[model samples]
Target: MRENEGGQERPGGEVEEPFGFWRGGGAHERVATGFEETPFGEVWERFLESVDTTNVGALTIGYWGADYDTHFVYPVPLLVEAAASFPNLRSIFLGDIEAGQSEISWINHGDITPLLEAFPALERLKVRGADGLVLEPVKHESLRVLRFESGGLPAGVVRAVAGSDLPKLADLGLWLGDEAYGGDSAVDDLAPILSGERLPSLRHLALDDSQFQDEIAEAVASAPVVARLATLSLAMGTLTDRGAEALLSGQPLTHLRKLDLSYHYLSEPMMARVCAALPGVEVDLDDQQEPDEGEFYVEVAE
Candidate 1:
């Protein structure tokens, strides 16, 4: 979120850089690791040698390593090193590998606090995986877009984010996943952001990939942030009639530009209702799923 909320000049003598899915949307530096074809030590050596670190603004890391255990051992140190070296780096997406390297849910992680401390200029950071994840209550001023896609987002990580005071944060996304993989955050635990007191600057909120999608949806329907948000994503969940019904009956979300409800379990009738309710909004109802063995299922459970 380097750009101003309205796409003006960013504060702090900077310009907005492309990030996340839009990583290469602007002038970005791309670096990838051949974990399968090369040794980790060699990969690090090459990464160290191949970048215009001083002038780099956006960096997208590809395929840190393979499997559940190996990913934990490679990137953190290298990223910490980059944090010190990549002075101009504004955006970083760690663990940008596909399911073949390691599924988003199964990817193992370690402490990421050092990277946060290292890169003072970082305006946006997106990470995959939540297992063994670690984050301290952030006190960053530049970070605006922070997203984590995971199978199971731990409670501590959620609480860490809750207590964080990211004054410039405009987009905050948390994948509060299933409890079986340590997605232990309850609806009550997310009181700060859901209450919209923590992130006063947020304009986009994604509380997704959970067993309690309906509960979260119920909360978000009345959340103060909804009045100001540009996009609201509750994708990759078991969002059904109950949750959709809440949105239909709740305060008018007429101000929103996009409503993402991808990977859901909604009946066609209920989906029809949501579409009818928010006629002008771009409602994403793609990948509608069915229950497994008569029980409703979350899309990304590990």
Candidate 2:
């Protein structure tokens, strides 16, 4: 059917209603009549028809397989609009299927304040390779988890989150690409988040890196006092003895229960050092094993 840029209906073919997930598509449920193809907006309205509850648990949408390139030039707004339509929506997972779409560019083009403004019920947000988000102004009471994947993020984005009223937030995850790794990276600028006035309510933080190693560890160790932080996952492309030391020594995650340092970048010496430093944090299954040093062991708390 033909439609204007605003998604307003013109005239022609019948509006294509949103097909739900089922084995046989439209054959499973009686198609709703009077459904007009008004554009993407109408499609989205039809999509919202599937939601019956005033409150929602989560809303996640992104490219899968070839959809990454063949689909919309930008899908964040559609997902965000869905969140707005559902006042109960709690969490969002806007991640792409990385297996084949890793090469696509994710550049931040403008501010993301409008999205936050539209979805006041938003709580947990996960975006990978979503760019141009001015996250400083978002102030949602239900928000507690914020995770970003790739693309250049302005320095102090986390600190800006600290300024918001996301007190219930318990997890924060950030990943900077190879350009911001190691000593030459922007690891130092994250001090605001790792130091004073940090996200004090945080309980978990995961940082996935493509290149940076030792510098990333040091930066993580220096994170500000998050009294509830219990887990730290570092997925670095490269890690050395110094990196392990930086990750293990110092900082206060006294209640920390899990630490994942399994990248092959760590040498035997580095692994040993981590065992010595953390005392009881276990080696992730992905890491290789050697003779027991008997210095430390980890058990899932019962």
Highest lDDT scorer: 1
lDDT of 1 by residue, 76-117 (tens): 767787566777778888867777666676666788888888
Tell me the spans in candidate 1 whose CA falls farther than 4 Å from its real position.
1-18, 21-27, 35-37, 66-72
For all candidates in order, the CA lDDT equals 0.77, 0.49
Per-model tally of clashing residue pairs: 0, 12
Each prediction's TM-score against the native?
0.86, 0.65
Quick one: best TM-score, which candidate? 1
Give the alpha carbon lDDT tens digit for every residue of 85-186 in model 2. 466555555543242433323432244556667777666666655344456645576666677655334444544554565656666766544443211236
